[model samples]
Target chain A: MSVTAPKGFKASGVAAGLKTSGNLDVALLLNDGPDATAAGVFTANRVKAAPVLWSQQVLKGRAVRAVVLNAGGANACTGPAGFQDTHRTAEHVAAKLGGMGPGQVAVCSTGLIGERLPMANLLSGVDSAVRKLERTGGDDAALAIMTTDTRPKTTVVEGDGWTVGGMAKGAGMLAPAMATMLCVITTDASAGGDALHEALTQACRVTFDRLDSDGCMSTNDTVLLLASGASGVEPTQEELTEAVTKACHDLAQQLLDDAEGHTKKITIEVVGAADEQDAVEVARSIARNNLVKCALFGNDPNWGRILAAVGTTSAQFESDELNVAINGVWVCRGGAAAEDRSKVDLSGENISIVVDLNAGKQTATVWTNDLSHAYVHENSAYSS
Target chain B: MSVTAPKGFKASGVAAGLKTSGNLDVALLLNDGPDATAAGVFTANRVKAAPVLWSQQVLKGRAVRAVVLNAGGANACTGPAGFQDTHRTAEHVAAKLGGMGPGQVAVCSTGLIGERLPMANLLSGVDSAVRKLERTGGDDAALAIMTTDTRPKTTVVEGDGWTVGGMAKGAGMLAPAMATMLCVITTDASAGGDALHEALTQACRVTFDRLDSDGCMSTNDTVLLLASGASGVEPTQEELTEAVTKACHDLAQQLLDDAEGHTKKITIEVVGAADEQDAVEVARSIARNNLVKCALFGNDPNWGRILAAVGTTSAQFESDELNVAINGVWVCRGGAAAEDRSKVDLSGENISIVVDLNAGKQTATVWTNDLSHAYVHENSAYSS
Candidate 1:
């Protein structure tokens, strides 16, 4: 139950012989709509990918009919030719979808940047996916966009008379600004462009934005939401936002769980900050610290590295007032040693770290993964 | 030749029980005064160690008689008690040196943070070091202040009629705003306090300030310059600065070559930027990127990662006009793949990366080490 769990949506995935392994690398999602409303978020990186630039322009129309994604080539930094390839790919998908205009289609790609896509293979695969589009193909679509991710990530949230569903793919190069990920979310609730944008923004701000598996922000991160009012149930804005956020949170958790070479998933909860922004900043700083992540991998409750990372941030907190707890044990209190390090158990796959800034009432939680030898191996050998 | 290469300086290193390994963990550098003009730079970390705080105050007096260093504990985040320990250590060293004032002593420590120093063992070691102090003890003094360093780092610069000699120790937790390092530089030049301060500032601005080993800034980074004027050579401010910068650059290069768990030394040169600040910013962003570092470790000419990193900075550069070269191969020209990636060889211990923005004429170079599994292993297992 994923993107297709919502009404008026069909998805498919197929191998295009583009990936060297001959794995499924092409995915398509279609909105069979009486009314199509869309919203999207793209990478904040200044060097936007060709597909991201194309999709941003397409979303300006506030309507979308189809989404075509390929994983064998990222289609980024390929100059004007890259943008032309994206335009042709979108137009091809629109033409194959029975008279839909090019402006109604979105194109996304992930993999090696600075390389041209195999247009023949990608276009043929798009046609195959459009022909095989089925109501139960969401899982396959999720599996298709992955690079180094170990599993497909999909989630569905059911409302009283509406549904929201999503699928996301990413592993390495996962940081804020949505990571090196491609996400497709669908809803069957009656919503306009403004409502869709508001809901998607609110949903992603606390969900996908909080997952920082690594400190590397990608050049090709995109998340799109398509709403088809075919269900005839007009949900309120609050209800739509809640459902979308829940679905996104579920999918984001899956991404972290399946992140490359990670053995431990850490939930960093920063509390007692001056404000939510301060909490988020402090949490992000701690989450991105390689030394802290390495200690997490070794299961060595090293709170000193945690404090050292926090010190680097401009967040509100007195050095001596900070406290840290790992796996339910307060390892540091008042910035000094508190509980016994031996009391902290890190044998489980999930690690909980609580940092009390002791400044104010605001709080935030960021999710991250530990730095492991396998992470080094996967990334170092990835391009080769 | 090192810190002792300069006249009017005597250095010594002694083993203290502070280290469980019973290695040399204490060092003393005494400036024989005809004029003890001093200037120093310290870590920018807000959560500074007690010794840093003490040394900052000492530098304000523009005079220093001795420098005491320990390696077993950082004496950071230890609250007022840590400050008291640093204060007492300074006073003890000053007392043993024939009634020198505590304000004339600058104390430095590098090791585990959030721990108090063992006062009894540290003071005893200071006495022992003073008893063994000699003019030729620079190498021993360099060796004493090491935590995970593989070898002692020392440099000497011979001026027209004077000399600048220095010793530095740091292996990890090194970044701009100084590193988790400690250095003592002694010069036999005839310079006043203001000239010493200006020369030291100018020297460090381009030398120690440009090394970003890991993105982590330390709490105990301190660099001190003591001018004895014993050689009776009065050099120009420019000449003094050039010699000091050369000495610092030599030491900085040594630090990068001996960085913790690194198999290769990387020099990131960002040219054609709008200004030196922009160049430094762009270079630092690329240097700190884990993906780029990983690619370097694998000897992969992944210019895409370099471009992705440059995109994240606010540095002036057109997305399509950026160029990157690995070693001497222009792998990327005009932000697109130009040369064959296989032609770039990374078999050597030194790797040079050049990124051209084509926006201006300014340039900057920063040194860093690649991310390795050993880095994670050493840091994770360090505290345990």
Candidate 2:
């Protein structure tokens, strides 16, 4: 019960001919509410997909009755024809849902980019999904959005008398400013569009925006939050933001766990920074260092590579005043070898690397995965 | 003949016990000149090695008579003891050269970081190298400076009565602002320190500075140019710069050919940019993109990945007006699929990707390599 955990929401998933595997490739989420308030965030990549451009326009109207998402082809780089395909998809969804205006429906697509979607099959899938929409169809909707993901990611957070539910799908191309992923959230609390956008912006800033899987941004990243004020529970703005943050954090962790071809889930925690930005910059530099990632995969506590990565950042830290600890072992102190490297055990899936810049007191954490042979194989063997 | 191809230079290579394999790990290059004029460039990495710091100080003295390079250990992240080891090595080289000042001797070290050098073996090897130095020892000196490089990189360019010759060694951790490699160039032209410095700077700005293999900057990258003034020919600054640039370009190409685990040497050329910096920024963004590299390794002309990389830069270009070609096949035109991707051939070892911004008249190019399974294997299986 991801999106359906909230009140006055229905969802369904159905198979379309868009994916050659004949798997469920289309999903629809409907908001049957007295209040239809929504907010969204999109990829920062300048070359965005047609669906992303369409969804941005829909959200600007400050009302969204439903969402239509597919996992077969990313309608990107197909020129104006691609934008027309997205418009037609939204219109088809609106017609199937009792002939509502196309502006009330948002669309999203994820798969191989620079390809057009099969309109006839997608329209038929949307018709079937509208007919099958039910309160308990959220699980099927979660499964329909998966491309390379091995499992579905969903979470629910309970408030005093309301609930927030969300689902996300991503496997690779995961980096800051949003990964190559799609997400949808539903809340049954009495909040306006401003409150929902504020909560989502704040939550994603700390969660999805800190995940740097490969340091490659995507062109079709999207996250949507729909509030259907059917629970009659008017929670405070702070309360709503807190619950949304928790839900986003849970979903982000799930994405990290299922990252493609990853054996080790690494967490780089930077402390004693001059400011939060400095901490983030330093952490990101370490997260994106392929040499450091390879060393972690080999279970070698090579603090020298980590220090070299730190040096690439313009963060405030003296080279001779820095220290690093891996899995509770201080392998390096004051920018040089201190404790024996053999004391650090990296034979686990969860590895923690802590960097202490003996500067002011500011901290940040970034999540990433170790680079491995499987990562190269998965990325090279397949086009996606 | 590489460094010793000039008129007044003698060099030798000797095995040092610092390397467990007992390979030729120590090299000495002496400028037996009536006038010694030199210039040097080091790594841009803020966390520099002990040898780099020592060499930077020595270059400021406006006279460098000799250079001692070792390939067994980097002598980096080893704290004050590492600096002392470098100082001691320089002093020993000076003493072996008949009591010359230690400040006139420069040092370079490459290999695994965070390890102390075996001073006794290194000094003994230095003594042997000084005694064995000859005008025909350039090939041995080139061999001594190699860590994982399979072949020696050397080139010669003739300029009227003067000549410029150079040698380089590097296999990985190659990026802009200097690769992890070390290079030494010798010139037999009559020039002062200022002219040599200006020519050397201009030569490197367009050659070594454009080769980015793995995007990992090393803490120990050094390139030195020494003029012996033995040719007795005063060439114009343009002539000197032209000759030095040719030698550097040849050596840079050699480094690219020998990049570790690379199946394809890629050249990303950006044209029609608003300025040179924009072209370089766009080219580097595509060069450093792992997705693009992986796609190339798989022999797939995935132009969407290339377009996405181009979008990541803040270069001057309209999304709809941008174009890209893979090996002369216009795979993407006007930001959409154009020529059949099947027409593009990627079976060769050399690949060229051109991105046209259609925004201006400036252009630039960056060199990189495809990511392969061997890359992951080499980086993971070895400590370096």
Q: Give a tens-digit lDDT track for model 2, residues A21-121.
A: 99999999999887889999988888888999999999998789999999988887889999999999889888889646999998999888777789899
Best by lDDT: 1
Which residue runs of candidate 2 sit more than 4 Å off their true CA positions?
Answer: A178-180, B178-180
Query: Compared with the true structure, what per-residue lDDT tens digits does model 1 show for residues A54-137?
Result: 999999999999999899889888888889999999988988887589999999999998888999999999989989999999
What is every candidate's C-alpha DockQ against the true complex, given to 2 decimals? 0.75, 0.67
Expressed as tens digits, the lDDT of each residue in B1-384 for candidate 2 is: 999998999999999876778889999999898668898888888888899999999998767899999998998888888999999999999988964689989999998888788888999999999999999898899989988898989888888888898899988888848533799999889888888888888988888888989888888989999999999988899998899889999999999999989999999999999999999999998888887888899998988888878878898898888899999999888889999998998899999999999999999889999988888888876673
Q: TM-score, B chain, candidate 1? A: 0.98
lDDT of each: 0.89, 0.89
lDDT, candidate 1, B17-65, per-residue tens:
8778999999999998677999999988877889999999999999999
DockQ of 1: 0.75
Give model 2's DockQ, 2 decimals: 0.67
lDDT of candidate 2 at residue B135, scale 0 to 100: 97
